[model samples]
Target: MLKNKKLAVIGVGKLGEALISGLLKRNAVEASDVTGSVAHEPSISRVKERLNINVTLDNCEAIKGKDVILLAVKPQNMDRVLKEISSSVKPDQLVISVAASVTTSFVEERLPDGIPVVRAMPNTPSVINAGMAGLCAGANASEDHKSMAEAIFKCVGETVFVDESLMDGVTALSASGPAYLYVVIESLAEAGVKLGISRETSTLLAAQTMLGSAKMILDSKQHPAMLKDMVTTPAGCTIDGLMELEEGKLRVTLIKAVVKAAERARELVNTQTSKFSK
Candidate 1:
């Protein structure tokens, strides 16, 4: 779907670089078809050396004539970047923003009228082509624009459409999820070390187990509770381990963690809106 399209990524930071790398590595878009803008001259050289693409410090110059413009700037910097390029962004171009806590309305309000905007929240795993993204379209966005946004993210990993109101939940559950899972993995690895396992082997075991479990959830299409039941045989060791987790209130703790994170996400959105309000 993205073939023959020129993409300009604003703020070629880590996530921007990851998307560009994924696009090139997957043959979704050729390196020559992509241009990236960074804030400073030092970053221009960094992007050029790392991605071998055309790099510029001028946001307006970088986005000129581009078919799709990915706004990968930090949320705190979104207003400044949008104001910088708003004049250059044409109505025909698709604008996709990956800024956390920044909404489609927030972006659309900054750009020219009828400029389609898509808000996407993608995690760090996108760097490895195993990410998950939650997408939503602004009022002016058309079906084709939505598809283009999906195609861009699908190059890196999975994409799911959700209502704009639920974006904060998605941000907390998936975008911030990797960090929480990493903590779980670390704790599991420490348990292995306590059980006399080598640190390297323990980490591999913990990480691989988490990966396989997640795959099973996705591939089997069975309720996670059902899968847990399948693993818990009568009076088995797995049941004993599950009991320990229950005693520790692990489920409730995780639920509260996500809830708190979502609350924080909403707060940040309001903060950004206030900071950028006209």
Candidate 2:
């Protein structure tokens, strides 16, 4: 969808760098078609040198004449960045924001009315093209805008479209899910170490198991429960492990954590809206 498009990424941090790299790696956009806006001299210099793309400290200059503008800045810095570029953003340009708490309305309020906006929650996994991204469009956004958003995200990872209301849940699940997985990996690794496995080997086993399990879910087309049941023979070792997890209320804990995180994401959005209102 971004073929031959002039795109500007208005944050050159790790996520921004990842998106840029993904786009180029996937041939989504050519080097000359991409530009980066960053405040840190080192990041700007490094991205420019590595990608051979345009990089500037000025957000407005970076976005000028761009067909797509990616708002990759931190939530707190969004207002300042928008203020810096609002005057230059063309009315027809599509704005895609990956900011955690910044909603579509939050972004639209900063730009001219009628401009298309898409709010996406893409995880750290996007850095590796294995990420899952949840996307939503503003009231003014057209189908074409949605398609563009999907195309861009699909290049880096899987993309799912949902109502803007569910974005908070998406944020809690996929965007914050990596940290949860990391904790799980660490815990499992520690358990392995306690069971006499070397720390290095335990870490590798934990990571590979995660990778393999994810692949199975994607490839099998079988329900996850079905897959689990297939491994769980009657009175088997797998069943014993499952019993231990059940005793710890693992599923309940995860469900509660997801619910709490979603609520917190909603609170963050409300807070941003409140602060902007004031």
Candidate 3:
């Protein structure tokens, strides 16, 4: 979908590099067709050397006349970056933001109206092209614009369209979900060490099990509950472990953690809107 498109990434951080790498590996856009901007001189040089793409420290120069502008900067610096590029962004250009808690409305307010914009929340797994991104389009975005955003994200992993209002929940779920998974993995590794396994072996065992389990769920086409039942034979060791988990209220606690994280995401959104308004 991005064939021959003039694309510019406004950051060369970890997430930005992953996105650019994914785009190149997928042949979504040629290296010559992509440009990047960074705050420092060394980062600018580093992206150019690493990705063989155009790099600049000037945010406006990177965005100028680009068909698609990706705002990959941090939320704290979003206002400064947007304002810097606002005058140069044309009505025909499409702006895709990967910054969390910064809404399309907030972007539009800072830029010229009628410039298409899409807000996306993508997590750290995107660094490995195994990410899930939740997308929300702005009022001025056209179907073609939305499709381009979808295609770009799909190159890295899965993309889901949701109402802008629900983007915070999406952020809380899939965007923040990787950290939750990491916590689980860490705890399991510690448990393994306690059970007499070497630390390195326990880490590898826990990670591989999690990876295999996720793949099984994806490839099996069976409900997770059914899959669980398949492992829990009548009066088996698996069932004994399951009973222990239930007794400890593990499922309930995990559900509550997700809820709390989603609430925190919503709070951040509210705070961002309020701060921008002020």
Candidate 4:
């Protein structure tokens, strides 16, 4: 769907670079069809060398005549970048923002009327094409715009559409989830090490187990509890581990973690909006 489209990524940071790489690798968009902008002259060379695409420090110049403009700058930088490119962004073009905590309404407020805006929250795993993304459209975004936005993310990983109101939850869950899962893997690896396993082997065991378990959940489409039962016998060692986890309140702790992160995401969104409002 994005084959012939000219896309300008306003910030060629890690996430932006990952999306560009995925698009090119997936043949969704050619290297020549994409342009990227960075904040510094040094970064211009780095992005150009890394992605082999045109890179510039001028956001307006990068976005001019682009069919899809992706705002991948930091949330705090969103307002300034939007203003810089506002005049160049035509109504016929699509604007997609991957800036965390920056709402579609906030993006629309800065651009001309009827410029379609799609807000996406993609996780770090997108760098490896195993990411999950949640997307929502602004008032002016049409179904076609939504599909194009989905196509961009799908190049990197999976995509799901959610009501805009649920975007903060998505941010707290999938976008921030990798860090939490990394902690779990690290802890499990530490446990293996404590049990006399070598560190490297322990990490491999922990990470691969987690990967396999996740795949089971996805492929079987069964309740995770059922799958857990499949591994956990009545008097097995797995049940003992489960008991310890329950005693440690692991489940509730994870639940609270996601809830707290969502709350913080909402606060950050309000802060970004208020900062830009001024």
Candidate 5:
């Protein structure tokens, strides 16, 4: 879907670089057709060296004539970047914003009317083409527009469409999920180390187990609890471990963590919308 499209990524940070790298690696877009904008002169060289794409300090220059513009800026900097490129963004082009807590309406309000805006929350795993993204379309967006946006994210990993209202939950569960999972993996690895296992092997076991478990969930399409039951036989070692997790309130802790993150993301929605809703 994006083979012929011109992609302009504003803010060639880690996520941006990862997306560009995924697109290029998958031959979705040619390096020559991609352009990226960086905040500093030094970053210009860094992005150029990393992606070998056209790098510019000017956001306008980077976006000029682009078919799809990915706003990869931080949420706090969204307003400034939107204002900087608002005059240059054409209605015919598609705008995809990956900034957490920044809504499609927020981008739409700052841009020309009829411009299609897609709000996507993709996690750090996108850097490796194993990412998960949840997307929602703005009022002006159409099925075609959503497809275009989906195609872009598909280059990196899975994409799911959800109601805009549920995006805060997606942000909390997926966008912030990797960090939480990393903590779990680290704790598991630590448990192994305490048992006298080598740190490297312990880490590999913990990380791969997590990956395999996630894959089973996706591929089998079964309830995670069912899968957990499969390993947790009568009075088994797995049950003992599960008991410890339950005793430590791991499940509720994770649920509360996601809830807390969603609260913060919702708060950001208010802060972000108030800026442009006026």
Candidate 6:
């Protein structure tokens, strides 16, 4: 889908860098085919050096003649960036937004009429080529547009399509999920430290275990509960640990955390939409 496609990335920040780097690493697009733009002059050189692509300060210049434009700007800055490039973005080109809580309709309204927009929520794990992205297409986007957008994200990891109404929940779950998992890893490492394990070794053990466990679920294609049961045996230490986790309400706490985050994301979307509507 990306063959011979010229790409533009606005707000070449961390997520932007990770995405562009993933594309280049996967040979999805070449350094010469991508243009990146940053808000500051210093970032121009930084992004250029890192991605080996043309970097510009002008969003309009960066997007000119590009086949796909990826917006990696902050949620609050999305409106400003969209308006800045609205005149230049063509209907033939696809625009993909990774700004959290921003909907495809939110992007479509700010662009030229009938321009295709794909809203995506990708996580930090994309830095390691193991990200998860949730995508939803605007009214103007065709299946081809969606596929092209999916190809870009697949370079980093996996992609899924859902209705726009579920996107904020996707943002809260997958995009915001890494931080939650990190807390779990940290707590596991702390338990190791309390048991006289060195902090460094404990952290490595905890992180690797998490990675392995995740791989098991993916590779086995079994329910997580089934996997958990497999790890528990009659009078096993694993069951004792699971008991402590249940007693501490870890599962419920996690469920509540995701729900709360989703609620906040919805509020932000409502506020942004209200502001634009006004």
**Residue 60's C-alpha lDDT in candidate 2?**
84
Q: Each prediction's Cα lDDT score?
A: 0.94, 0.91, 0.89, 0.94, 0.93, 0.93
- lDDT, candidate 6, 9-58, per-residue tens: 99999999999999999999989999999999999889978889999999
lDDT of 3 by residue, 153-252 (tens): 9889989999988887888789878888888899899999999999899999999999988889989988889889988889779988888899999999
| Residue 189, model 5, lDDT | 97
Candidate 1 colliding pairs:
none
Question: Candidate 2, residues 147-203: lDDT per residue as tens digits?
Answer: 998999998899999999999999999999999999999999999999999999999
Q: Show the lowest summed lDDT stretch of 10 residues, model 2.
A: 269-278
| Best-matching candidate per lDDT | 1
Q: What is the lDDT of residue 107 in candidate 4?
A: 94
> How do the predictions measure up, each by TM-score?
0.98, 0.96, 0.95, 0.98, 0.96, 0.97
> In model 6, which runs have C-alpha deviations exceeding 4 angstroms?
276-278
Query: Lowest lDDT 10-mer window, candidate 1?
Result: 269-278
Candidate 1 lDDT tens digits, 86-115: 888899999999999999988998899999
The alpha-carbon deviation from the true structure for residue 269 of candidate 6, after best TM-score superposition, in angstroms, is: 0.9
Q: Over the full model, what C-alpha lDDT does candidate 3 score relative to the true structure?
A: 0.89
Query: Is 3 or 6 the stronger prediction by TM-score?
Result: 6
- Where is model 3 more than 4 Å wrong at Cα? none
- List, residue by residue over 1-278, the lDDT tens digit for candidate 5: 88789999999999999999999999999999999998889998899898999999899999999999999988878888999999999988999999988888788888888899999999999999999999999998889989999998999999999999999999999999999999999999999999999999999999999999999999999999999999988977998888888899998999999999999999988977786455
Give the TM-score (vs. native) of candidate 1: 0.98
Give lDDT: candidate 3, residue 276: 60
